[model samples]
Target: SKLWGACRNPWDTDRTPGGSSGGSGAAVAAGIVPMAGANDGGGSIRIPAAYNGLFGLKPSRGRISSGPSVGEAWTGASIDHVVTRTVRDSAAMLDVLAGPAVGDPFTIAPPAAPYAKLMQRAPRSLKIGVFTSSPYETEVARECVDAVEETARTLENLGHRVEYARPEFDGMALARCYLGLYFGEVSTLMDRAKTEFGARDDDFELDTRLIGMLGRTMPLPDYVRRRQQWNDFARALGAFFEGYDMYLCPTAGQLPAKIGELDTPSHLQMAARLMLLLKAGKLVHRSGQVDQMAMESLARTPFTQLANLTGTPAMSVPLAWTAAGLPVGVQFGAPHGDEGTLLQLAAQLEEANPWFGRYELLEAMI
Candidate 1:
């Protein structure tokens, strides 16, 4: 919070640009700079890209080394990339930053040619699956769903085969597994806070404190089981991709969140709310109300996690706008080593429907 103090959406200052990388999102959207650094451990990159009307891609795991200082992040669930206004910018940056550092644990093969140059022409006809369902069965906003449908039409017009399909998995179980890993990371940060900053419960957000408590008390075997679930989910998606080059979905289940709508409560305030739930016997993790709240919070982002879990390459392309004049993006995910396909498609889409014109309008308004 101290870093930027609630970075707001340029389109509407009363709305958020989206998370962890929201600062980058806001800067790019407002034309403060052409591109900015971003990273995605979950939907950190794509979420912001969707909210701010930019292009953001998460490359295959190990495509960009996270070495010298650290080998992997979030147990390899995270990767570094950038949010960009142009697909070519992202591709050029990838060409610059991608490679294995000495003694790195693993590495992905380098691109056949510089990505910036590769975008010079359209890609060959490919098979694309149009998937719109939220894994959590949460209600996706109409605008978000419409964005996927519109993108599918545009891709088909670009000579790619499009079909309706989705990977099979238990949404609730995957959420549990992901939350377990996330909580473990939070617990680690808590340790750092105590040691370095002398921080305590009062210093954390309500959600962070509660999640940390759960992580501290969680059994070791349970954590292991959650990781195992990650492997299982990855395998399932791998098989599902056998007949398709990529799966297209909404970047978010909803539009950008209004300011203060998704704000984090201070620990003390949250503790009071927790007591009320506890009194009603609804504080347990398995409680229906608790589960509903968790789902709701994640509802806008249920589609982005599968790619992160599988270490696949995925991208958010700014392809549509809502009646309220907000941007909503479509996400395209390819198999673990097929980032080139996503880049090529994004370039083609850029040519078909340029967004710089919209960026110019935003500049005039601001």
Candidate 2:
């Protein structure tokens, strides 16, 4: 995507496959492979699955090793697994990747049975809290709302106790913290590029440069404070899980955007260019523009970050599609280290509403 342009969805070229795992989603959806590797920091795996109509799961923190060198990614908000058309493939992949690396910082208990075995059957009588609104209080599209409602109905019919609810937390605050991670990661990586590769300011794209600049201007104490706030969110979600077996919401706040629709608009681009030219990163940060950037960049992606932030297992189950034939997915989040529950539920949904063969039908039409 850096140079080749956006990866278009195989089902409809006008729409994206979602990112940054969108390429893997596209490759799997277009039948290039049965499965491909993916990860989620803030919905990377689930976003692509929602757009491309696949089963994607983000394992709980430390369920899979982050690295042999660095202990974590995105401050433990990210973990790697796979995206697949069938739930079983994801479960099988998890079994393969589930273990402690030699120098891992976090260690999670392994599943009692392998996930492939766990996901083959449904978890009984799940009390799922369902919501369709954005945590950031932004608008969720009508179709996205409808997808969750429909799935809620289907879940109810399947004898699961479905209720309208969400975990208690400051959505905007969480957004700020998430963006803070972005700033720090971008800035640190930019410096690494300069040190490791002799990269210049002009070498990066405008958005990357802007985020990196914000990172450079960010205060270390503020970064530490924001990281600490993640605990509050984790506790809130933990409290919610006391009553709810899992949480259900739209995987994305809206359907996939038309390519380039999310790009910084011309006026903003001009403003950003001016800031970069003048090295006015702190000024922009003080102007409360970061909030605007969060809304612009993350409004559509608010749902999946809770799992990432809380180090819980979550999945996007492809149970709905729009009238235009674009896929929309419903998310299911389980308690920490409870990927087996999410996977089992996903397999149940897959059985009740089969989506695996739709691509073959699309191929026929094409």
Which candidate gets the maximum lDDT versus the true structure? 2
Residue 323, model 2: lDDT of: 84
Task: Compose the digit string of candidate 1's lDDT tens values, residues 137-220.
Answer: 988899998889988888889899999988888888777777778878898889899999999767775566666766665568
Per-candidate Cα lDDT values, in order, are: 0.84, 0.90
Error of 1 at 95 (Å): 0.9
C-alpha TM-score for every candidate: 0.93, 0.98
Tell how far residue 286 is off in model 1, in angstroms.
6.3
